[model samples]
Target: MSPHDLGRIYRSEIEEQPAALERLLEHDAEIASIAAALQSRGPRLIRMVGHGSSDNAASYGVYAFGLLPHWTAMRDSITLTVHYDSPLDLSNSVAIGLSQSGRTPDVVEYLVRARRSGAFTIAITNDPASDLASAAEATIPLEAGSEQAVAATKTYTNTLAALVLLAAHLAGEGARIADGVRRAAEQMAESIPAFARDAEALALPFSYTGRMFVIGRGVEFATAREIALKLLETCRVAAEPLTATDLAHGPVAALDPLFPVWAIASPDATLPAVQEAAQRIRETGATVVASGTAAGAVQGVQYTLPVPAPDEPLLSPLLSVVPGQLFAGALARVRGLDPDAPHGLSKVTLAL
Candidate 1:
């Protein structure tokens, strides 16, 4: 592929993220209505299901719903519902399914079962008319439009925005949540163009890298996972996602000289621990690429790719993942791969 043509589609979608988020927030009134219904039910638990990038969104949602609404949340085991067909009692709980296409069979089936078991089911998807949406009582459309790239970029961020809006409404802090979401989108609008150029330059040095680790803590851990998946799919890099706290347990032993580590951290409680791990990993002669607002604060990282983010840590993931998406596309282009079409993958997976 020509240098000018490489990753064109994927990069374009990454740049569309800000508009996608703005569109999602335009449906704030609908999200507020859903929250009112949820609040009225006084649900005690939230069970979320998704596959791939949607699952990573669910991982982030687990924390957001828990922290904001003060409800117990779990990344539900889809296997139990899809494979084992185990009877589940979801009374007084909310079940949410996240999917870009909203056509994942497993997700649709799980929501169908949840609704049957007395749970109020919701679908967060780009397609409100998709099967997953039909299986649910309510749908929060991502409004991300059609993503040409096989790997998700705008849809993932929009999913996060939708979740944040819903969680904010449920928590009863309408103004604050709206401000946070709006600010985060504005930051992305201001920074993404520069971030894309920077990511392309950054990818040059690591184009030959075979494997690496992407680390984060708390809600940002989901950012790590999403980044790793992007690199794996777009650049064909074996990027492993790990929590910074878990690095000391066993994963740190894998580090070696020239090994690349992407440490994603925000200015939150998890910052100190993530910074500590980055410094420790730096001692191994591994190159650390620090990302997010805490990038400058972290010591010993070989490269810093700081991103503009919100004051609230939960909202940071929406911004933090931008660098990852850019890096993935840039690296793919540098490595002579077309990020728009990776081998053996489609835009949507109809998981059984």
Candidate 2:
């Protein structure tokens, strides 16, 4: 099937991300102020909590904090913090909660617990007035508007953009973020058709491939997880996301020609490690394809998908995740499934 023939609301949302990201970057001033306030308090640690797509976005935050500020940051489990009442001394920390709808019950509870424990709580969501926003000390609106499709596209990318803005501010690299955001947006706009064409071609031949492993390191690790989730929800593929380091230790043995491996290579310090991992996977005879922006990021791969390799590598997620979203939507359509609505998923997942 051609890209045009597989039109769906999910595809529309995937195309909508460039504009939504432009809007998200407009809130730089607000993010700057929040960063200033947080810096003044000198947070020594960051604890982020979310579910599903939100969790994937928050994983980028964890990586950002470590890379940019060299601080200790973690993505905490909401179930343990909420249901089991896990104890944490968050006095010198900032707790962040992310949810697209801003109403995930356990995520809200995570923020509440953090706040009660004297941590600074921040909420990131598309809804400024959501319960998650209300539960935190401050909020960062996703500015992605209403994502009508059950599969998140704009919201997920916008969430990453918002987090990058916040990370830039905290790292005192605020001046560079706007330029990076603009370039990423432009590149994303230019690359959309290329991604669509690649998606159509790949899906036509490989849509029925039952399972795959996605691997990346550092910032791109979140991209790996997000893409795997998209494949699972949309194409009904059993996609497992793994770290490049961990996979080499053991999981690499399970990979071969029949089991596909998607390696995300970003133009950053971690590129060498990821490239090595992808090269190793390729030798295993698995159908290994790569998605990245840098000229040599995907070197030696049999198939490649291009995205903006942004000057600010932290913001690459805004561009990298787009091609993955398109692939998932196109694969769903080619496989005789609806990309907009999956079989057992909904827009907002409410769990106690």
lDDT for each residue of candidate 1 in 42-104, tens digit (9 for 90 to 100)? 888989999889989888888888788777888999999879988878988899999999899
CA lDDT of each candidate? 0.89, 0.84
Deviation of model 2 at 319, angstroms: 0.9
Off by more than 4 A, model 1: none
lDDT tens per residue, model 2, 119-166? 999999999999999999899999998898888888898888877788
Error of 1 at 348 (Å): 1.4
Over 4 Å off, model 2? 1-7, 295-299
Clash counts per candidate, in order, are 0, 3
Query: Which candidate leads the pack in lDDT?
Result: 1
